[model samples]
Target chain A: MKCPKVLLLAAGLTIFASVDSVAGDVKVIANASVKADTISAADLKRVFLEEKSSLDGSHVEPLLEKEGRAHEAFLQEYLGMSEDDLQSYYQTLLFTGRGFMPKVLGSDAEVVAYVARTQGAIGYVSSAASAEGVKTLAIGVPSSNAERKLITRVEPDYPDTLKRLNIGGTVRLRVSISAKGNVEDVELLGGNPILGESAAAAVKKWVYAAGRSRTIAEVSILFDGR
Target chain B: MSTSVTDKLRVGAQLYDRNLGQLGQYHPSLDWAVADYRFKSWFGVRGGKVKTTLGLYNDTQDLDFLRTFALLPQSVYPTDLRDATIAHLGGDVYGSLSLKHRLGGLAYTAYAGHRSDSIYGGVAYLAAQYQVYFSSYGGLQYGGDLRWNTPLKGLLIGISRMNEDVTGKAKAINPLNPGAGFVPYSAISKADWADQFYGEYTAGKLRIDSEYRRFVHDEQDQTADIVLVEIYDDVRGWYVSGSYRVTKRLALGYYYSRYSVTSVAGGLLAPYAPHQTDTSLPANHVYDKVISARVDLRRCWNVKVEGHFMNGYEYSSYPNGFYPQVNPQGFKPNTNALVVKTGFNF
Candidate 1:
């Protein structure tokens, strides 16, 4: 009986260790000169994809680790692409003359070093890696926790015809929250246009937590006809 | 060379091979050398030699690595007139407007300038079209393009318009007297206006592209004393293409293209009969069906094999001039050819 319990504990410990190793944390780091301390995942993807070159009104550059655990995680989690697909995507951009290949380093140490010396450079590294000279950025959750809290909630009314037909989708919106927590504006980013209209109207009526200045937030609302 | 002076200011010079291994000397020339300043996401100004935004693929036709097919549909991007349609020397105003929410985006470009004629290719193509030997001087070219990237991923719709005024000197040879020197035939001027509409949809591994184009060419032939021929030629072309990405390294594509030119007086000629003296023969229309398979050998290299089944002949020739024997009864013939091409880019 004791031997069986010992075996069970050993198995539990091994599973925990494997989980820890596979779910290793990643940290987004930037040069010391960068003004922003937090970034949204969508913005991070956009920056790395070369869709936008500026962040919070400051010019910025994105660096990639050549190959490693952190590199794989960044590509999979943030960019939603495999390494090969990412390379092909970059090649397409280069051939189209829309963008250039970003600087790539071999290791986390090299990435950290490059980001430290280069102003406005952004990169990702393993959370355990030493980031002595760079600033680490926190991923912002637009509509939850410490970032912004929903005080007043307004549910969008599903269209009657759409409900009857079982038409449903997720509508993404960019909401502007004023310093006083009032919803200032809402713009539809994507979804069925008709559904987007109702979503925007409901988002405009919602209230957020007060902050020092206006903050832009991305939120998604799903309608499943229920 | 491209340098980003600031977050919103960029200057660059783009150069591309003039012939893409299809014609004479392989020389690289400037496609666009420009300074662009962006005031906002919706507005920008660019000045210099700019890529003419005349068609769906014209702006990036030279970028072989970005295209799936080894060769673009020749009915629209005819291999011979590449230089004339590549870029224009002047300024342009371009911008992108993000539609409400993330519904989609609309990009637009408008420009005006003169295009330099390639002595070997562009001039030759023009000469063949008018059925006379000619030396060309480049002319004014201007156009605008608007593309809407729909909310549906990988779907795009666009429309473009272009106008060109080309001028050249034509000379005719007397076929009956083979030994005599050529005579000054007419000073030819051609005004070509074209419009095109295109749509592309890409979903996962499947891709579809289609385009329709129409061109109107008005020509005036004149000597020092009198005008000889004044006519309008209408040409229409369209293509439907689809591709499937079978794997990470391989893709297959097929396309059907058709080109037709209206029977015009300039394209007609008198029959050999003594009683017949009016322009009567009609020019032939052309059709091409192509199938292609491409394999990416590595990150930087790709090879493509393509087969083209072609029908019809382009049968416009000078009056009383030498005619080729391919079309004996004025009926177009069918031909087939295979092409293999590889591309490497860094």
Candidate 2:
């Protein structure tokens, strides 16, 4: 069978576009004191948010660009937060004694120079910037729908009594998955409560494609009886 | 001002005016000062005058830029009572712990300290109105707070409890014999404690929060011989609030607050009612409804406006912002307040 020309061209462009964007946008840089040369997006978010202070047995700090294209891309791709929201979050942390403001720099050159000189510092700059005297870290695939491809599924068992009684409908659930791809929790979104519980029990045994961060997915199971 | 002394240690101090000279002109007072050191995720220590973490907003109340409302729920966090419970002199042990199997994480704090009241605060303002001049007001204090960040995406819940051994001295009307206009008096609290529980949920641009708090104080008074005087008080407050980020530049919020108190007094001068020795009148509570709007003028500047509709006034030494002393002419069943605040950060 031959693929359509338009479909082939579209697929090619999609691949090229993804590669281009990922390769040319932002580069994660770290100081000499940092032991890891590759960082998961999950850990990056945690460090930047002040939720975690160390990475791979070494103390670490996050430096941010005040404002720029690289800053915007990093915020959206890894942190999934707006600059405004990030600022408010920092303000809350400072006043609560949980965290203080991290160092912020002006441009890609400034970030590169500072990361190269400051111990335990981790920062990001445009891919075009020179990364002399610093380590570049590769980020894992970002969390998205692609990360939740089902690997193993447990079929829900319908109670014989309900099936005999012709009680049938679709049970909807909101599922929480851990970073390592196992189901962490499940709660009923909509459906019969009894069916929801049975469905949740089965979903808890499901597994997904491993990802760098936690993710929430919606699932539905159907029961039919005549 | 706050700065990190090292990677693991930080120090800071804050100063503020209770009210912008509305209740009365007053000198600035220290809000909090402390040095914090974190050794790990499960153990850390703080020393000096440390801030108290009672509810969702207690420690962050002064940071106006962090919230959508100009005035928080007064029933739970009264502006006038800021000095009495904001912080204590001593130390605290605090940390955050992660649990296995996606159970989420726990953050906790425990502290023991000395309570010190300021004459320039709302407590003194109310005392003056009652003709009770306090020469001293303070004592031992201790508390703890625990919060859980559950596996559920954006939900958090917490509980806090604090106990104080309160002592105070003043010149006031003798409770043993009401005929004697003024005399020296002293108070030693047998039980003074506060308990609070709070929860918050955030989904995208919308946030919802709720908290409930209860305070109890039982005191023994020092007066003329052969006369025994004691005081008992119970106060309760709670509020539920919601806010949304309507756009990049605008936000809106609303909250309902309820405050109430019950009390009994003895030979010492009365702090609330003029003629009654014990009371639980409906006027001892305040129920408030509020609506607010916030606008971000710039990345570092924002303005907040809010309106409050209250049904009653707290009529005791509780020192909630709405004090009976501030309103000598008397209080109506309903009151309204409008607030507008702006901030600039660099």
Candidate 3:
């Protein structure tokens, strides 16, 4: 009788723990017109992080809820970034003249309202503020602390105007993606004229598996003397 | 004249320009500048400069002080040395001038003048060339030379006379012995001799320059007429050539030439042969053709290897290669030669 009671008590504790985890801290919302029957965790991450710039040739813009428990959880789980790191990344991009951070609204209600008005807007809020105006999405939780994989190569019909004299140098790039994965701006840190355009073009088509549907990424170009 | 290889090496740039390219009895200009330095025990280097002009031509007496008289064989003399043969058949000697400065960030060199022999109305030349560069892991260049620098780039055009003699004071004991006879012309004779080779007025010359993306140069000279062995010999003509880069590493070039010469002498030696003595042949005239290809490959940092081939008519001189001469014999001027060179710049 004693053993049975102990087992029952342990089972009750486990149930309560699972319930707590099931109640998500933040809720992601897309425009009601978003016609996807179901979005994968990877696709949701791509949308919010700016990795995917467009959907069906339509521009995708991401919105952010102002700082709060829900905003912190969303960034940490879906973007795989701490609040401090995300701020620092934006600061770097802004000073370099690459692009700006996504627009932040004061409340979850504001995010929902913006997404409702915009054709391809995306945002996140606390589950408590979830409502009918915005379609809720399940963004993927980050498995590890690493940058999301984006674009790999540019198209073949690009110009061959400049001779690529890789005289041995490094180039750093910071990029921001829209929900549909389009690179809007680019900044070159250190490189000759040859590699700048190619790097930018390829980064624009990057599709992040982590952001699901949103991402911002930084890359380092290494020139190994061949 | 009485030095060994080691002794010559010890004397350095002094002897190299002395015996080399010894033309006829024209006096060659004598000039030399040498400097030696020794800093601490770990470093030592030598610097020197010398320039000499040499060529074969008659002497004129117009410039009495700079005359270049000739030395003929004992059997062909008109009694006195002055009246001997009374022909301009020797080289001129014009002195060479050079300067070298190697210190700090400025290393430079400048050269001017010549050395040759000629008599009566002889020619005098004023020339100079300069270059300055740095000496580090890699070298840097920022100066230009203006003397006898034919054409190494772009389009190559123009006639250049690098051969001239300067009448020297040294005299030889034997006139027939090659090394025994020293230059036999006075300063006037030397100047006259120099003048003959360069002063003899002629519209065409050995020249090279660039045009558009092509490089071209041509050289023509009228030698003496041949008697008996030929019907007509009044030599005169021009050899022209052009080169174009087909690719970054490859190039193609072509050349054409026409030469003519009078086979006979005009004065006393005319009766032996009628057509041979005719001056109507206008000296010399002949036709020629040539083609060439060049290849350049990158080897290392700022280093490149180059190779080229040239084939054409009457384009090769008897002694010197790039200079063209009119041939009396009706022989085709077809030659094939290959060359390889490596270059480095910083």
> Which ten residues in a row are the worst by lDDT in model 1 chain B?
B272-281
Give the Å error, residue B319, model 2. 3.0
**Highest lDDT, which number?**
2
Q: Compose the digit string of candidate 3's lDDT tens values, residues B8-73.
A: 121222221112112213443222332322221112222342221111111121111111111111
For each candidate in turn, the TM-score is 0.70, 0.75, 0.23
Ranking of all candidate structures by their lDDT, best first: 2, 1, 3
TM-score (0 to 1) of chain B, per candidate?
A: 0.83, 0.89, 0.29
TM-score of 3: 0.23
Q: What's the distance in Å from true for residue B336, model 3? A: 12
- The candidate scoring highest on DockQ is 2
Ranking under DockQ, best-scoring first? 2, 1, 3
What's the lDDT of the predicted structure labeled candidate 2? 0.75
Per-residue lDDT of B248-315 in model 1, one digit per residue for the tens?
A: 88999999987766534442222321221222222345578999998999868999999988776544
Off by over 4 Å in 2: A1-27, A37-42, A95-98, A127-130, A138-226, B20-24, B173-183, B224-228, B266-281
Q: What TM-score against the true chain A does chain A of each candidate get?
A: 0.54, 0.53, 0.47
Question: Which structure among the candidates has the greatest TM-score?
Answer: 2
Give the Cα-based TM-score of candidate 1 against the true structure. Answer: 0.70
Residue by residue across B1-346, what tens digits does model 2's lDDT show? 7888897888988776645444425667676788988787578899888888788888888888888999888878887666667888999998876675567778899999988877666766776765767777888999999999888968999999999998877777765566879888666898699999999998889999999999898877676443345667788899999999999889999999888887777653454334322334546888889999999999789998999998877676456766655576888778898888898866
